[model samples]
Target: MSRGFKKFSKNSYKFFLLIYKTYKLTKKFHEFDRIFKKLYNLLNFVVFSVFLGVGYGKYCIK
Candidate 1:
């Protein structure tokens, strides 16, 4: 019985460690995803503004 309990405890500890590591990795992935999305939005906005400026300039010239 003591040996069985020790084995069980060791397995449980390993399982908990795996879960903790997975949680940390997923958290980091979410943070990176958020940063990437923000950067993508900013890039889109800059490109749109540049296009608008060119269009307006062309209209003014005409």
Candidate 2:
């Protein structure tokens, strides 16, 4: 009946999952230093892209 997708919740869910994975990995293994950095970088990229997309949608599209 309604759209299942909303940008805030969807992106925030991705955020939550990234945080959870980072927590779990840190809790389990010190060897995950490289992997943890990768996830952190990925989270930065995701958030950046979301903001960029929002701006593009608002300003560049009709």
TM-score of each: 0.52, 0.49
How big is the positional error of residue 3 in model 2, measured in Å on the Cα after superposition? Answer: 26
Candidate 1 regions off by >4 Å? 1-28
Q: All models: lDDT?
A: 0.66, 0.70
lDDT digits (tens) for residues 1-62 of candidate 1: 44765577578657755755675577667775666557656855775687678778888988
Model 1, C-alpha of 1: deviation from truth (Å): 79
Backbone clashes (count) for model 2:
0
Model 2 TM-score? 0.49
Per-residue lDDT of model 2, residues 1-62, tens digit only: 11333566577768877876777766566556567668867977887788778778888898
